[model samples]
Target chain A: MTAPDPSPAHPVTGLDDVVHQRVRLGILTITHEARRVEFGYLRTQLQLTAGNLSQHVTVLETAGLVEVEKGYEGKRGRTWITLTAAGDQALAEEIGRLKQLIARVETTSTPEER
Target chain B: MTTDSVPAGADPRRLLSDVRALAHRVRLDQRLTWVALLVLAVATFVAIPFDYVGMDVRCVNGGSECQFSRDGVLYYWPAALLIAYTAIAFCYVRAARARGLGARVLPYALTGAALAVVFTTVWLLARVYLADPPTEPFPGWVMVLDRLVAPAGTIGVALLVLARLERNVALLVFTLGYLAVVLVPIDFGWTIHSSVRAEFIPQQVINGVVLLLGAAGFAIARRRQR
Candidate 1:
């Protein structure tokens, strides 16, 4: 429940844990480029069950990182998901932090590690 | 601050690699679209100059006359291809944005406008304005090749890109439409020279098959996902 540190040197600690989770991170990365993703498409890509994906999506929705839409395509019910502005920003910051973490590792590693 | 908070067994290198892969996947379509554009651009550059070089006059009834005809055949084919390539790139980028399936009309309109401009400029330079008239009748087969090369590369690259993106119908429509546009007209109206047809037809056929196969793969992948 701490605010993300604004300084570049402390990037990793500020990483949004919500976006740090692998499946949700994947969803955000995919949806950031797509106009919106169908629920089925997301489920298939992430290899998550209907219930599992719904749970992750609920977490994202609760955090205001994603918006879910329900409608019907032809005779079948359909769900579509898209990242919200906050979600997009969170994903960007998370990626930036990951890059910074990698840079830190590179700088601090021993010669044998290199 | 210490790296202790990274938790046990957390590998920074692996995390970076994973995120990089994710980003690469997300941007695949855009990268493919640019490749398609670049391929067409290079093909046009190489093909047009070869077709236009050493042509000095229009042949009227087997007599070389200093007539006011530009290399109309040469100019028109590349012009058409340029319009087509640009249209496809613009459409692909927009469709990747997912407004709808083959939905936007602006690219098509822009293509028409581009062709008109090319036609007008080439015409003005070669005929009306009398800047520099072409020396001879441009070869029909070269024009045919020009028509084929650009779309072949543009759509060919697009097929590869869309296959990765898992956009089944878009890939199918684009492949089929490419075949129809590039192959059908040449077969019916322009295949007058056997030598020209022999050289280019087989290549076009190969391109068509590759595009269709790629589209089919995407379709299969999409079906499995559904």
Candidate 2:
């Protein structure tokens, strides 16, 4: 089969379903930087409520961009989140594509429109 | 952050390097997992220092004549070991963090070890104060040590299993299977030496069987890829 078209950040990009989205992209970007963070920590950093955070996590999970692990530390249940390699690569490619588009828009624009 | 770090396009070498580094860090943690269990080992040894160093012990049963006593070396050995075990435990925790999931065996092993430590403290206390012996024999400490040691041995075997060395599996399987084969007669109380045959022989054989199972489990660990 033919390979997918190459992107600037990534050699070969996968489905655009999750990577093209805004909030999911934000979530994946933050996760890639932090090795592995707690669910509450992510929610706090994202400034999203319990419901919003949970929904975003589900979307990312479905796209295989993230892994959500929940286990008990003691009496209380704890959840940890981490970005999958696929998610990381996808994010990089998306960021590259976005920047390239912005550069094109700026360079082609009239000086007055700047 | 950018593809410029390596190349503009995908580089299998770059990806492999990153993945390999992360994998190595995780393994380092697993390798050192058992150091945590060493605490129990040290506890057992701690009892050695105080074995019979100062106190005078005696087996003064309700109406019995006499039996045992205590000494210095007995106490010193266990005490020294306890210190050593603590050092070993620190290393183990560090290693566990390195190995990632491989270190999962640590918690249970350390907990069992901690339990053994508790029993050891009780046994040593009893030896120093209550019923005593001439040589200050540790009463229930050995069993605690055994409980911890057995799991440690299992974890070691698990690591071997994790490695998935084909030869090692065959060797381990052979060794365990051989032991099970040899233990057959003894477990059934048919040892050439009458004294060798005991009620606990079955348990020993059972442990051998379990070892074989552990080896089998390791062989299958790779079936589920990361």
Highest-scoring model, TM-score: 1
- In the range B16-62, model 2's lDDT, one tens digit per residue, is 33433433433332443223323433333344334334334342455
Query: Positional deviation of B162 in candidate 2, in angstroms?
Result: 31
Model 2 bad stretches (over 4 Å): A1-17, A112-114, B1-226
Best by lDDT: 1
Worst 10 residues of 2 chain B by lDDT: B1-10
For candidate 2, the C-alpha RMSD (Å) to the true structure equals 17.5
What is the lDDT, from 0 to 100, of the residue A100 in candidate 1? 79
lDDT of each residue in A1-114, candidate 1, tens digit only: 999877554666676777777777777876776647768766766677888889888989999999998888678787888889999899888778777787887787889877
**Model 1 in CAPRI terms: which quality?**
incorrect
Cα-based TM-score, every candidate: 0.51, 0.31
- Each prediction's RMSD over C-alphas, in Å, is 10.8, 17.5
Residue A111, model 1, lDDT:
92
